[model samples]
Target: MTYPPPGSGYPGPQGPYPPAPPPAPPGPGYGSPHGGGKTNGLAIAAFVTGLLGCFGVVGIILGAISLGQIGRTGDRGRGFAVAGIILSCLWIAAGITIGVIAANSDSSGGSGAAPSATRTKPKEVDAQKMKVGDCINDNTTASAPSTAEPVEVESVKIVPCTSPHDGEVMAVFRLSGLTMPPESQLRQRASDGCKIRTRSRISRDPAANSLANSYYYPTDESWRSGDRSVTCVAVAANEGTKLTRPLAR
Candidate 1:
């Protein structure tokens, strides 16, 4: 074997063989930088897949994570993340809009409120607003209505009493007969049922053997409704008055 000397164009087998030409360009350092682009593409694909599916919300979350990773590593998932976020927001907005629309549609079933232990009462019912000769009846102890009777003259009012007991005072009258003042100005002294003879005189009569007084309530509606009268006693101005009358049948 002939050994070549240094500077003779022949390796002397003493140093590192000229570094081996950098190992053939390192076979494309980093396995083809194209891999980074692929990572970003995969991220975008995943985001789209998630958005189109029912898992849009999940997609958004995953996309966000991928985007974060891309920012940190220069990876390929950024597109996916952005798409997911947009779709997720749209879904959320749709749900909210639907809720608002349903609420305002005026459906009886749509009414809602947290259940409260407190009982709510019905509002006041004004029977007086009935037609001139119409009688109104309530569902509770209040008497059924009778037809109203508009008398020939408007001067007379039939102020009637019911059971001769004042509904308001919670007390019964000792005697019967009109409790009104001599002058007919204040036609009805006691208002048991609030019925009035718009054009008739009011008279009270004690029950034939019962401690009850009957006040006559005359109205044109009562007469028309085939009801001649209502018996009610005067009501006191001050009594823990009923907040409202029960609903009428």
Candidate 2:
């Protein structure tokens, strides 16, 4: 049998549906009752900057947090969150492109050139092993079998000379690998494929092989070894020119 119902186990039909459970306490950062829910100023700034990519990924983080909080308070600013995502994507794209270009420009010159940089050799100095800041005082030309027919390269040698046309200064870097240049990088400022190119020559030293037998300078192409690519400048070794010494590497 049911007991009398005043404050019994079962409530009467009325009682306003148990007076609705007490509202949940405000979240951690919401503070005391006197203080109301407030958003962080830095978070707002980050969200805005992130959309511009100025904040990069940092902005994305801030915007995400702010966006999440908005759900709890029904706030606005979808623009800021979207902006942060856009910025992060842009930063990633730019960074990736830069990294790839640098890698391509640095393909290697596989041999022992980089390691033997300290060794001294007989006859002509191995100039290719020189360092960035180091300067050579001698201009001893090295010789190899002429790769071109008719021994067009005589014996693959070089001397010193200055530019008559006085071309502008261009790129610079250390020498490595076989020192053989890429076919594309060099051009005879005067002739087709230039009969003979010099690094920066005005004339040839009879001492270091003749123009007919010398290696062309101002190499039109870049060369690769184990893992390094060397750049060269173009200088023709035709007549009306001379070779100087202590060539700059």
Index of the highest-TM-score prediction: 1
**Residue runs of model 1 more than 4 Å from their true location after superposition:** 1-36, 40-42, 106-124, 131-249
The Cα RMSD in angstroms, rounded to one decimal, for candidate 1 relative to the true structure is 15.9
TM-score (C-alpha) between model 2 and the true structure: 0.31
Badly placed stretches (over 4 Å) of model 2 are 1-43, 51-55, 106-249
Q: What is the TM-score of each predicted model, taking all chains together? A: 0.34, 0.31
Q: What is the lDDT of residue 116 in candidate 1?
A: 32
Residue 231 lDDT in candidate 2 = 18
